[model samples]
Target: MTAHETTLCTLFAEVLGLPRVHPGQSFTGLGGDSIQAIQVVSRARLAGLVVTTREVLRSESVSALAAAARTDDRTRDRSGPVTPPRRFGPLAATPIMEWLGELDGPVDTYNQSLVVRTPAGFDAPAAERLVQALLDTHDVLRLRLPEGLAAPVPAARIPEPGTVSAAALVACVDARFATDEELPALMRGHMRAARALLSPREGTMLRAVLLDRGADRQGRLALVVHHLAVDGVSWRILQDDLRTCWAALASGAAPAPDPVHTPFAHWADLLRAEATSGRRMAEAARWDDVLRPAPAPLAGVRAPGPLDPETARNTHVLTLPPEFTGPLLTAAPGLVNGTVNDVLLTGLALAVLNWRRDGDGDGPPGTDPAGGRVLVDVEGHGREDVVDGLDLSRTVGWFTTVYPVRLDLGPTDPADARAAGPALGAALRRVKEDLRAVPDKGIGFGLLRHLNSHTGPGLARRGIPEIGFNYLGRFPMGDDRAWSAAPGHAFALDDADEGLPMAHAVEVNAAAHEGPDGLTLNATWTWAGNAYPGTRVRALAEEWFAMLRALARYTAKPGAAALTPSDVSLADISQADLDSFESQLGELL
Candidate 1:
C-alpha cells in the first residue's frame, strides 16, 4: 500500500477498533455507520487529513479516502459551559409520555434494564464510582415526576447532574461467595431498584446493582432506568461513553464526554416552543390528512384487565446469522429506497395481515369484517436532521417519536394461501411509499398531539394506533463483538418485563447482532394475551420470521422490480378492483 493508503488504514483501524483494514474492505463492511463515519472525519481532521462525511460515505477503501483526503484549516464552534434554564422546564408531556402516563395503571411497565459482564476482577467500589461518574455527567438522571406540591422550588431552575443521592446511584450485592445462592436475593434487589425508579417518590429515575462475583471470574453490572430518561440510541451513546469514561477514571483521569451542547431540558423546552410555530402546525395538518379516518390500528388485545402486574409481555424470538443478515442489509434497503428499518416494518405488516387471515383476531377493535387494512404505530429514534444547529446525537433522554402508519394490503385471503403473495408484495410496497411520504420521519405527531395547544390525545381528537413497533438497530455482541476491543467484553440490554399487560394489544422490538453465531435477529413480541391468545401471538412471531426471509429472497432475485404498487392509493382501489387486479396479476406476481 502507498503511504497515504497505509495512513488511512491505520486511522480506520484505530477509530473503529479493528485489527486491520484490508484494501478491499469498505468502511461499512468493517461495521462502520453514520456516527462512526463522522467520528472518522473528525479524527481525520485532527490527524491533518481532511475528509468530509461525503467522502467517507462513498470511499470503497482506505486508499480511496486517502486519495481524496486533504487538509484544510476551518474554524468550528465548541460547546461552552452549562447555562441556566428558563422555559421548557416542566415534565412536558409529549405524545409518548402522554401515551404511557394515560395508560390507566402503574407506569412500572416503562422500566428498562441492561446487564453487563464487567471486566474480570471488576470490584464494587469501581462500579459504584462509575455509576456516580455517570450521574455527575448526564443530567437526564436528575429529572423526576414532581411528585408533590411542586417541591416549592424557584422558577426556571433545572436540577444539575450529580445533585441526587450517591447511595441511590446503584443498589449492589457482593455475590462472590455464592453466585447461585444469591440469585434470588439479587433479583429482589434489582426489582426493588426498578420499582423505586418507577416513581418520582424516590426523586430518581435510574437504579444500578453491582454483583461482585470474584471466584466465578465474571462480575455482572445491571442498570435499570425509566423510559422517560433514555431511549435505545441513548443507551448506545451511554455505554460507549461509560466504557471510555470508566477506563479513564480507572487510570486516574477526569471523565469528560463530547460537549452536550443542548442539555435534554433545553431540548425539551425548545421542542415545546417550536411546536406552536407555523412549521409544526403545517406539518401536523399534512399528517392529519394522511391519517384521518385513521386506518384502524390492530391489536390482538382482549379485555386489558385493570393493568395486571403479573401480566408480562412474552417474546417469541428469531435469530439470523451473517449468511442472511449481510446480504439482507445490502438488498433490503435498496429494494424500497429505504433502510433496514423499512424491511423490518414491511415484514411486520405482512405478518400482521397473515395473522388476520389465520383468524388470530378482528381488525383494530371494531368495524365488521373490515376490508384488508392495518394501522400500526411506528417508533423512530427522534434524532432526525431537523434540528439544524443542535447535535442531539449524544444527548440522553426520551427522544422517541410515535406515529400511525396505515398499510393497504388489497384483498388478503386466508383460506386460499395462493392468493397471499400479490397481497403481501403490494402491501410491502405501499408501506415503503407511505413511510417515504412522511415529513421528517414523523416528528410532527408528538408536536401536534402534546405541544400543540389545539390538539389533545383524547380518542375524539387524536387517534391511537393499538400496536407499536421498534427496530433498535443492532446489539453490541450481535456482531461478533466487532465493536469491542476484546472478546467477553460484550453486554446485553433487555426489558425486565413484569408480565404486566400493555395498554396496546401488542408491540414488537427487534435487535440485531452478527457473530460466529452468524447474524442473529432477536425479535421480542409483547401482546396483551387476553386480546390475542398466547398461541396466536407466537404464531405471528414465527410467521414474521418466515415472511422476512421470503422478503429477502424476493428482493435478491435477478431483475426483480422494486416497483411501487401504484400512484393510486390502495384505499382508493375498491375491494372489487383489488379482486380484479389480483386475479390478473396472479401468476405473473
Candidate 2:
C-alpha cells in the first residue's frame, strides 16, 4: 500500500473500530453495511478526505483507491465555502419546541426516490426558473446560517435571489444522476456533504440530490430530509409544491403560495424558554422516574456492536388491512380510551408477552417467564400539546421524539386478554398525560441530561427504550395505484423498499391502508437478526394481533361477553390469519 492508502486504511479501521484492515480490503469484505459505510464516509470527511462508495467498491488495491480519491476533486474540500447559490426568499428558522423535540435521538427513518423523467418539454432555462421560483416561495429552501456561533468569520451568505447559474444547477444534477447504482450511494453522501457544507450546529438537518439525466429527459432528483424536520404530511406538501412549481414553469406562469409561518429561530427561542423553566425541571424529574434504564441487552444479543451484514439478509413487512383499523378506531374510546396508536402498543405488548410465554427460543432461557419485560421504547410525535395551534406542517424543524413507555407484562393475565382492555387503556391515558405535560415532554432535554455528568452514570449507561414503536400517522399517499404526470412514474413503496435502517433490537411501525373490505392496519416489525429468530418474530406478531382483536371486541361490547385464548384458534393463529382478521374488522368499522 502507498503512504496515502496506508493512511486511509488506518483511518477506516479507527472509525469502524475494527482490529486491522489492509488497503485492498473491500468495504463489504470488511463487514460494512449501509450504516457503517455512513460512519466511514463521515470519518473520512472529518479527516479532510473524500471517498465514495463506488470507489471503495471498484478499487483493486488500497493504493489504487487512494490515488482515485486524490484525483476525485469533488471529494476534496475547497478551502473556502462556495458562494451560496441564489435562493428565492428569506431563510427559514426552526422552532424551539421542535428543536427540543429532537433531543431524544437521531431519526433513522428516510424516504427517497429517483424521478427519471423531466417534465415534458422541459428546458434548462425553465428548470432554473422553476428552482428559483421554489426558493422564492419557501423560506426553508433559501435558509443559510450566518457566522458567529463558534465561527471565526461570517459564514458564506446565500447568493442573491435569482443568481444561481443554470450551469451550477445542472452540474449538481449531473453529479447526482451519474448512475443508477450511484443514486443510493449519492443519497447517503449528500447527507454528509450537506452537513459539511451547511455547518449545521443545531436543529434537524436537510439534504438533497439532483441527478441531471442529461438533455434528453432521464434526470433524477433525490430528496431526503431527516424525519425530525419533516414527516409524511410535510412530504405531501413538498410534493404538491414541486409539481405546481414545475407545471407553472412549463406553462410560463409564476409559482403559487408563499409559506406563512415564523422562522425556525422563533420556535427555537420558545423551546429554550420552556426548557429552562421551573416547570420543565419538575417535568424532567417525572420523566427520569418513569423511564427507568433499559435492562441489560437481551440474551444472545450483543450490545450496540458493529452492524453485521447478516442482519440485512431478510426484509419483511406485515401490513394490517383497513377493515381491522376501522373497527379498532370505532371501539378505541370504550376499550382503552385509546387511539389507534394506543391499541397498537397494547397489542404489541401482549404479543410480546405471549411470544415469551410460548418459549420461541429466540430470547435467553432465563428471560422473565412471567413476561415482566421492562424498558419498552415507543417513538412519539414530539409536538407537545403546547404547540397545538402552531402550523408546524409548514415549518422546517425536527418535531418528532422517541420516548420510553414501560410495560409490566408480568401482571397481565394471558387468560384475561379480553379484560386487559381497560387496563391497557388506562396505561395509555397515563402515557399521553405524562407526555403532554409541558416541562418534561421534550425528548431532547431528557437525552441531554442522560449524556451529562449531573444525571449520574447509570442514566447514561441505561440506553434509551429498547423496543421502538412509530406510527407514520396512517399512510396518507392516496390509493396504491401509481399516479404521475408521466407513465411509469408511479413507483410502489413498500416495507421492503430500501432506505430506512433497522435497529439492533425490534422496530415496529403501523399504517392504515385500504384493503378488499375496508381500512386495514399494516404493522411491520424489522428485527435484528442476531437478536431474534424468525419463529419468535412470527409468534410475537400473531399473539399481538390476537390480543388486539380481543381488546377491540371487549371495548366495543363491554360487560357483554369476554373472549379467551381458548375461544380463539391458537393452533391456527398465524401472521396471515391475523392480517385476515384485521381485514374483516375493517369492514365492520
Candidate 3:
C-alpha cells in the first residue's frame, strides 16, 4: 500500500475499531456504512486530506479513497470529538410515513424486529455499550413519528455514548421459545419486544436485552427497534458495529469512535424544502396520469374465515430447494433483463391471473380482483439519489418507497404444468418492460403524493393496492454463527415482524440468505386471514415456484437467454430496434 493507502487503513481501523483493515476491502465489505463515510471525510479533513463524504461513498474501496484524497492547505484540524447536529428541522413525509398518518388503525404494531440468540459468555455491559455507541452514532434513533400534520416534530440531538441509556435487567424463570408453536405476543421476546411492542413511542423506539433461561447457562441477546429508526441497510451496518464494539470491549480496548455524518435533521430539512418546492410540484403533476389507476384486487383466491379484528395477519414461510436456488437467482436475471424481484413478481402476477380465471368465485363483496392486469404496492429501499450531495445509502431511517405497479399480463391459460414454463417466461418479459417504463424507478409517485409542496385535484387519491411486495435483498450476517469465544456458544439470528402490523392487506417479503451451508431464498407472505383463505394462499405460493421453474427451464440451454435491460444497459429501447435503426443508417450512408 502507498502512504495514502496506509494512512486510510490506519484511519479506518481506528475509526471503525477494527484490529486492521485490508487495503482492497470495500467500505461496505468492511461493515463501514454511509454514516461512517461522513466520519471518514471529517477525520480525513482534520488530517489535512480534504475529501467530501460523497467522494468517500463513491470510492467505496479503501485503496481508491486513499488515491482520491488530496491534501488541501485550507483543511482544518487533525482530530476532534464527534459532535451532534445543533440544528433541528422536520423531515417531509416519506410515502410510508404519510400513509401511516392517514391510517386510523394500529400504529403501535408498526415495527421491524430482529432476534438473535447468542452464547452465555456475552456480557450485558458489552451489549449496553454497543447500543450506546449506536445512539451516539446516529440521531435518527431518537426521531419521533408525528401523529399528524397539525405540527412538525423537532429533531433530537445526539446524546453522548456514555449517557444514552442504562441497560435494563429483568428475570424470566423459564423462557421457552419455539418456531413451530404460536406463542402469545407478549411471550415472544419476553423482555425486548413485549415492552416495546406494547408501547412503541418516540425516544423509546429501540430496546435491547440479555435473556437467561434459568440455570441452563444458555442465553439470548436481543435488540428490537421500531421500523422508523432503521431499514434493511441500516440493520447491516448496526450488526457489524455491534460485533466490532463487542470485540473491542471484550479485548479491553477502547472502541474507536465513529464520526457524525450530515445529520438526519439537516437531511430532513432539505427533504421538506424539496417536497414543497415548485420543481417538486411539477414532478408530481407529471406522474398524475401514470399511476391514476389502482391495482387489481386478489379477490379471486378469497377463502372464508372469521373477521377477528385483533388477529389480522398470517405469515407463511417457503424456502427454495438448494439445487434450483443458486441457478434461479443467477440465471433468470440475465435472461429477463430484470432482477430476482422482477422474476418472482412476474410469476406472482401470472399466478394471480391464473387463480382469477380458475378458482371458484367465492370472493366477498367487492373482493373480486379478476382482470387482465394487476396492481401491486411495491416497496423500494427509497435511497434514490434524488438530491445531489446527499448520501442516504448508510443513513438509518424508515427509507422505504411504496408505490403502485400495474402488470398487464394480458391473459393466461388455466394452470397446466406442461404450459406453465412458456406462459411464465412471457409474463416475466412483460414485467421487465412494464417496470422499466416507470420514471426514475417509481420515485416520483411517492414524492408527488406525499412530499410535493402543492397538491392539485389533478392527483387525487385512488384506492391502494391490496398486495404489497418487498424484497429485503439479503441478510448481512454470514453463516459463521457464534458471537462468543467459547466452543459451546450456540447462536442463531432471525429477521421477523410477527404480531406486528402493516397498513396493507397482504405483504410479501423475500430475501436471499447466505450461510455456511449455501445460498437459500426465503419468501414470506403475510396476509389478513379474514380476507383470504389458507388454500388460496398456498396456491399463490406454488405459482411463485412455477414461475422460477419456467425461467430456469428456458435458460437451461446455453445462450438461451439474453441479459436483462436492468443490467447496466439503457432501458426503453430494445436491441432489435437499435440494430434495425443502425442497419437503415448504413444503407443511407
Candidate 4:
C-alpha cells in the first residue's frame, strides 16, 4: 500500500480499535457508523489528511479514500468559528412540537439519562463543578417550559459568567458497595430521585448525581436531562465536552469555552420556517401516503387502542454474538449497498410476515392480507444538510425525527434454508431501495406534520404505525475504559414514569456495542404487556433473529451482495439491466 493509504488504514484501526485494517476494508464494513465517521474526520484532520465525513461514507475502501484525500490544507482554512444565532424568546423545534402534540400526562418522566464512570481520582466536588460548567455552556440545559402553553415553546436564558451555579442541580450519594450486586438498586434509586428533580417549567432541565463508591472503586456519574433538551447525538457532544472540562478542572485550570456551536434555539427557528416553506409543503403528499394507513396491532392484541403509561409494559432482549454479528454488521450491509438498519429492517419484514403467516398470534394469520406490507415508524438523527450555512456537528439538543416507512416485500414465503437464502437476499435489496427512496432521511416529514398548518392536521389524522424501529448506531470499543457507561446500572436512561404514554404498540431499539466479547448486536423489544404476552414477543424476536442470521449466512457466499439501481445515485439503469450486466460480466471475468 502507498504511504497515504497506510496512514488512513492506521487511523481507521485506531478509531475502531481494530488490530489492523487493510486497504480493501470499508469503514462501514468494519462496523463504523456516523459517530465513528465524525471521529475519523477529526482524527484525519489532525493527521494532516483532509477527509470529510461525507467522503468517509461515500468511498468504498481506504484506498479509494486515500486517493481522493488532499495533501494540502486548502479546504481547512476556509472555515471559521460559527457564531450562534441571537437569543430569541420562546422557540419550538420540530421534534418538540411533535412531542407536545402527544403529551397526555405528567412531564417529569419525559427525560433522558446517562450514567458514566467518573474519571480516576475525580471527586464529587469536581463533578459538581463540571456539571455547572456544562449547564452554563449549553443553552438548551437552561431552558424553561412555562405552564399553560399548548405548544412547547421552551425559552432559554443566557447565564452570566460565574452566576450559573445551582447547588440543588448537583448531588453526591454515598453508595460504597463491596459487591456489584447492590449497584443496580442503588443506582436506580439515585437516578429516580435525580429524574424527579428535573422540571422544564422550573428551568431545572438537568440534574447530575455522583455515586461515590469510594476511592478504591470508580464512581458513577449519572446525568438526567429533559428529552426536549437532548437526543442521541447531543449525548455524544456532552460526553466529549464533559471529559474536556473535567480534564481542565483536574489540572487546576478553568476550562476554555467550546468552539461556537449553532445554538438549539437557532435550529428550532429554522425548522419552523422550513416546516412551512414551499419545499417542505411540496413533499406533503409523499409523506401523507407513507402514514396513510396504520397497521392493526398484531392479530391477538388483548386491548386494541393506543398504549399508555398506565398499561403495563414489558421488554425482551435478543443478542447476536460477536461471530454472527461480525458478518451481520460488516459484510451483510456491503452486499446490498445498504446500512445496518436496512438489513435489520429486511429481516424484520420477513419475520413479521412469516410469524403472522404461521399463526403464531404475533402477526397476521396466513399471508399478510395487505400483500406483505408493514408500516414502521423509523427514527433518524436529524442533522440534515438542508441549510447552506448551518453546521450542527457539535450542537446539542433533541434533533430526532420520527417518520413512517412502509416496508413492502411482496408475499414472502417461509421457505426452508435453501430457498430462504435467495428469498432473504432479494428482500434485503428490495428493502434497501425502499429506504433509499425516503425523502431527506425523513426529516421533512416531521416538519410538515407538526409545523405547517395546512398539512399538519391532515398528517396528524392519518395515524401512525403500530411498530417503531430505531438503530442507535454503533458504539465501538475504545481504550477509554474509565469514562464509558457505568456498568451494573439500570438498563434504560431512566425508569420511565408509569403515567407516560406508549407511542407505539411495539418498538424495537437496536445498537451494536464492541467489548471484550467483540461486536455484539443487542436489540430490545418493548411492548405493552397487557396487549401482548411475553411468550409471543419472544417468538417474534426469535423469528427476527432467524431471518437476520439467514441474511448474514447468505451474504457469506460469493456474489451475494449486488448494487441495485438505487445504490448508484447518478445511474438511471433499471434493476433488470444491472442484473443482466452483472451476469454477463461475471461470465467474461
lDDT of 2 by residue, 1-589 (tens): 6667777798657533456888766554443322234334434544555665445533555667688764324455779776433233323222322222223332232322223335423445655555555444444433343431223213313334344332333325354336645654554465344433322333213344454555554444434443323443444345545666676655767765335343444444455445445554455555566555433433112233322222344434665545455666445532322245545666666566555555543456535443454445555545443443343434443445555555554555554664554445434343333333324334545444422334424433444454567765432222222112222222212111133234436666665543335556667666766556666666666676776677556655544222222224586553335445756776798
Q: Which one wins by lDDT: 1 or 4?
A: 4
TM-score of every model? 0.75, 0.56, 0.71, 0.88
Tens digit of per-residue lDDT, candidate 3, span 1-589: 8878887888777655467988887554454434455556555655657666556645647889888888755335747675544433445445556655554344554455454544445555555666677776766675554443233443333333444353542223234452212222333546444444423343466666555433334445555666666776566556556666666776898554444445656655566666666666666645654444533446211122222222423667788764666666656655654556667677677666656545443444323345457777787766655676454533567667777777776655425422545555556677877787666567667666766535623443444566778877644234334332112221122233333334456667777654545566778776666556767777777776666666656667544454344443575766456445656766798
In TM-score terms, which candidate is top?
Answer: 4
Number of backbone collisions per candidate:
18, 29, 8, 1
Estimate the lDDT of model 3.
0.57
Best by lDDT: 4
Candidate lDDT values, in order = 0.60, 0.46, 0.57, 0.73
lDDT of each residue in 399-427, candidate 4, tens digit only: 88888888887756656422446677777
All models, RMSD in angstroms: 6.8, 20.7, 7.8, 3.8
Per-residue lDDT of model 1, residues 1-589, tens digit only = 8766776788777655567887666675565544456556545654566676556655767777888877544345547864554323455454566555545544543566566656656676777677776666667766656542133322223366657765756666667775544554565566665555555444566777767777436666667777767777676666666677667766888766544545777676677777777787777656565455532335321222443332444545567556656555555655444456667777776677667655444444322243656667778777655565454655677788877776655565422322334444555566667777677778877777766767544322444456778776655452322114223322323343454346556778777664556556777777665555678778878877777766666665654434453334664654346445656776588
Tell me the lDDT of model 4 at 83. Answer: 58
Q: Who is ahead in TM-score, 2 or 3?
A: 3
Ranking by TM-score: 4, 1, 3, 2
